[model samples]
Target: MNNLASQEQIIATAILIVIYMAVVLWLVIRGARKTTNIGEYALGTIGFSPVAVGLALAASMTSAATFIINPGFIALYGFSGFLSFGIVMPIAIYFSLIVITKGFRKYGSSVKALTMAQWIGKMFNSQRYAIFFAFLSLLLITFIVLICVGITQVLSNALNADPFWVLLAVVVFVFGYMMFGGANSLVYTNAIQASIMLVVAIVLLSSGLEYFEGGVDGFIAKLASIDPALVKPTNPDSLLFRDYFEIIFCQLVIGVAIVCQPHIMTKSLLLKKDEDVNKYLVVSIIALTFFFLVVFVGLYVRVYFPDLKVGGQVLPMDSLVSAYVVSKFSVYVSLIVIIGLISAGLSTLEGLIQSISSTITADLLDPLLGKELKLDIDSNQILTNKIVIVLLAAISFGLSYQQLVSPNLSVGIFAQNGVYAYFSAAFVPVIFGTFLKKTSLKAVSIASVTAIVVHFSVYYGKFMPYMKEEVNNPAIAATMAILISVVVGGIIHQLEFSKANNKEALNVH
Candidate 1:
């Protein structure tokens, strides 16, 4: 796809990247100065404006998958991809985020919960449950790998450099700075990244306007001329968006549960005042509506590369957006898009590193070592958190390198399998714990285990008809898991409640 950039473009990109890195480092240093303990590191002591935190939430929620990887899917599958990723998913996610955030933050702040695992543990009065989730949070490293691969693809193509070296440099620089900044720097950096991404989203979305010259029908006609399936709302040739169930139902369910991730849901805790929640949600929903629509650029890129090849080489799915950027835009404009792409990845990357490392250090290690072994982890938690980030960086690099060299379909699939499972298990617990006045820990725990089992089993075993394909859809597996777990959890909760009520009646009589 003529992915290599011109020497002039490469030099300009490198220079701008250096300036960006310097600015980010300066902000990290500024934030690190105020971060004296784990509490400040996880949920900053500073009272940031709701607008900034809202921007951060939008950026963190819209990962590289939105900007770089998922568009590749849209390019391959066409309008059906847009219907699922751009439309249905965003609507469900916004609704779920609005429903869950305020209640979670109210309890989280009241309990001084530092991580999602800690929040769940405290809500159910079960440290063991929190520990289990802390370990499960390791699965988010797959998501980190997805972001790293995304940034690597953008940078490597722009610089005409080796992907391995680019990946290494990205992981080191990001993870190294993240060792200090935590939430304090994360909010500001993410806000800046979000602003850049918002501009790029507009540019990419508008880039396809010329295709709409003959009107919306003309655009559909153009796609239909290439491949009739491209214009269809449901593409039979595609694995992920083959029917109403996959395109709408599965995506809707996934979108609702997707916010259960630590990096996403815990973002509300960044706000100090209750009054700020509505403003924060309003800004986030508005910005994210634009960010998710950027996937439409895939259809534009597809129209540009009808054969899905350039220079007689078939373009890889993960590299579609990168190839399009370098080919479609002038050198200067390409550099700006490249910066925004990097921001899209870095915003979510920073949040994952901060949240997961905090989960490991605060939720997992502190409970085991400090309480059980009587170790002084409390005094050295900051140091311990840095160590955890280093470990996570190493793991992310190994897995990302594998995906870069040889992926099943795209790293998006690999990420979805892991991330979807984690959140599917979390969905019941987070929902029941937040809204229900009296929740049975046993019921939630059973539901969580059921979710994990069902997700992996269905994914690996190909239990459902939708999963019979070689590259199965993780969303389908996740949806089944979420539904089954909710049913199982609900029944158990009712049984427990009824038994307790009966006991109270007998005692009163």
Candidate 2:
């Protein structure tokens, strides 16, 4: 668990990283040329293959959480973490992704929407609601903070650099490049990142093949040897995996709602044609399944670092995977793995910057201040988008530095709180908008507001049974919000329909 890399290893990794960044910058510059305005930047005008966008979706959806931080959870909690993260969560997410993508994409393409906030506004004929959600897109800054922290951890471990400098460098470089490329550069970079990630995922998943010396039972036995609870489906002493409610139910609800994010849901809109969607989905699902299973590497790392100490320092959960990688692999192999890890963060960071900046420029700032500012939003939107990215980078750097210095448990919790609240509020709108033909703005907006209230209440007020303790789970709060929102939204929609029917009948009579 040594955190320090050798001088040779550091130099080799630094050189390789420079070469990779050069190639990526070239792609960004090329894509930036085609991106003249916000529409083209938001959704690429250049025709891309479904397979590529599909891979990009997989890459963006599976962020640093999947590759780096979440593994730390598994390393600490064992089988229960695996069950929630690897099994139940994936089942719920994949099911939700398959269900929503088709309809969301179909509707999104028809509306010609640029952002998720725009999609919700257009669907319900409510610009005010769009503004609310656009401001809420600020919640995604927490996620940006998560990815920045994660990449900082990986790069810091590889080069034995200070986390502060690494964090600043990461934000400047990723967000700086992202200002120009938007979706066009993002998809190409993501596709390439996804390809490397697929290979890395396979390598990491198979790294512990020798652990399967006997069979499935043998793996369990080894885990049991370390700690009996490590093999259990639910670890009683753990913070998050205490019961079925937390492990299965909470994950199920969050999984269903997780795809409502602008970066993920709008990924399907990148494809120019409908016929390409099936192939896009097919490739993405397969690739993402592979990405999700890579969480198993967490369990492997836990076994690798049984004591969870590096240089006699108790390794923080966020730093465990990076320390393991730096210590486990040789210089050459670790160099490649380091690139894959950085790719994991950059791929998603790029998407979030693109989507959220567009949301700020188009959905929030444009509608609110365009006329007053006398900005020709349609003609010179790209400049506004660049401004948005700069603001995001500054805010993210400040928040991420804070989290890096003092975290609640991990930056993962900080991210989940903000990100979960967002998708929770968004779930009802996206669900009702995509599935129901007859729905009112009043119904959806009320439900959305209710979700926002409930999510915060459950988390901060400690209303849920689980939230009464320290290190409370954000999933519980988000799940409750999504559940309540759906019920409220459905009832309101039905009431609105019934009232309309009565009015029509009375008029006809």
Candidate 3:
């Protein structure tokens, strides 16, 4: 594979990444000095501004999933798929701003919530529920790390570089910043990254429109020419409209899992004031609206590069919509695209690694295994977090190498499916419990556990049978699992409330 980029483009991309790395590192280092305890490091000593929090939240929520996979879908499913999934983002922003702001502020700093599981446990008064939720949270973070690694590898391939080295470089850069800055630094960096992403996405879309023969309409015609189904709202040959609708609903609910995500919620605890939440909401929503255009670029790419192949799958690189421009445009423009996408990936992974490390240290190890290790919770937790970051980076680095050696063996399905299953079970019950004061801890616990177990069982079982030549989209399976969790969690929560009320009445009599 040719490097296919000019020296000027390469130098510019390198300079941009270096500047980004330095800025993020400086922020983290500044924050690190203020972190005296586990709470401060993991949750930010004082609250961050809502603008910062919101931007970080949006960036973390998008991740390589948006950068890489969404484009892949656009290549195959066409613009309709982009619209279907893309629509939920605005809804997510609205919920965060209108529905969630007041609730989050009222909850405030008292909770010291580092993970979504902790938030759920606090709301429901059940550590068992927290533990189950933590497991799911763990799975989600794992998938994120896997995706980060996957995208870095893909980027490396596109650059004609060694995939392992790219993974190693990214892991170290992210881990270093995250370990130094903690939550506060992560949010600050994310805000900057979000800005870069918005600018870059806009530039790519504009340039692409100018360069393409048909613009969006012309591109659509090309797609329809190849396969008429490309323009259809849904492809009956592949996915049904009912399935697509269900997928939309499921993704929307799963989107709530973002509210409960450890990395994103940690920003809530870091809020400098309640007002910051408002600012963060506005900034995040506005930025995300622009970023959504990135998906449109993917759809645009499908029109021209209909025959490109990735991983034995005949698919266009929808995820790298900007990269298509690189093949056509001057090196400087392509450099901008690379810089933006790389920033998106790096800033996101930085938050993810730190958040996961904090979870392992604070939520998992210190609580469960610290005493046996003969160390106090606070000091030991810090040490453990650092160690976990290094180990995680190494593991990710090794995995990237393995992926390059045997691309087929390195399919990212396991991580994605596992996360979907975990979040569906973990977040649905907790969010529902938050609004229902009467929702019992016991019911929450049962529902939470059942969601985890049932999701895993069906996921690995006959529900999405592996025996099929063309497997059902993991997105569809995930949506089904989330729906089941919502139904079951709601029922269990109601049942527990009724039983508790009856018991109280009998005791009073």
Off by over 4 Å in 1: 1-3, 371-379
Per-prediction backbone clash count? 0, 0, 12
lDDT per residue (tens digit) for residues 285-393 in model 1: 9999999999999999989999889899988899999999987889988988999999999999999999999999988888888666333554488888998999999
- Model 3 Cα displacement at 507 (Å)? 3.0
Give the alpha carbon lDDT tens digit for every residue of 126-164 in model 2: 899999999999999999999999999999999989889
Q: Candidate 1: global Cα-lDDT?
A: 0.94
Cα-based lDDT at residue 260, candidate 1 = 98
Order by lDDT, highest first: 1, 2, 3
| lDDT score of residue 7 within candidate 2 | 94
- Poorest 10 consecutive residues of model 3 by lDDT? 310-319
What shift in Å separates residue 2 of candidate 1 from its native position after superposition?
4.7
Which clashing pairs does model 1 show?
none
Cα deviation in Å at residue 195, candidate 2?
Answer: 0.1
Give the better candidate number (2 or 3) by TM-score: 2
Q: Which ten residues in a row have the lowest lDDT in candidate 1?
A: 370-379
TM-score of 2: 0.98
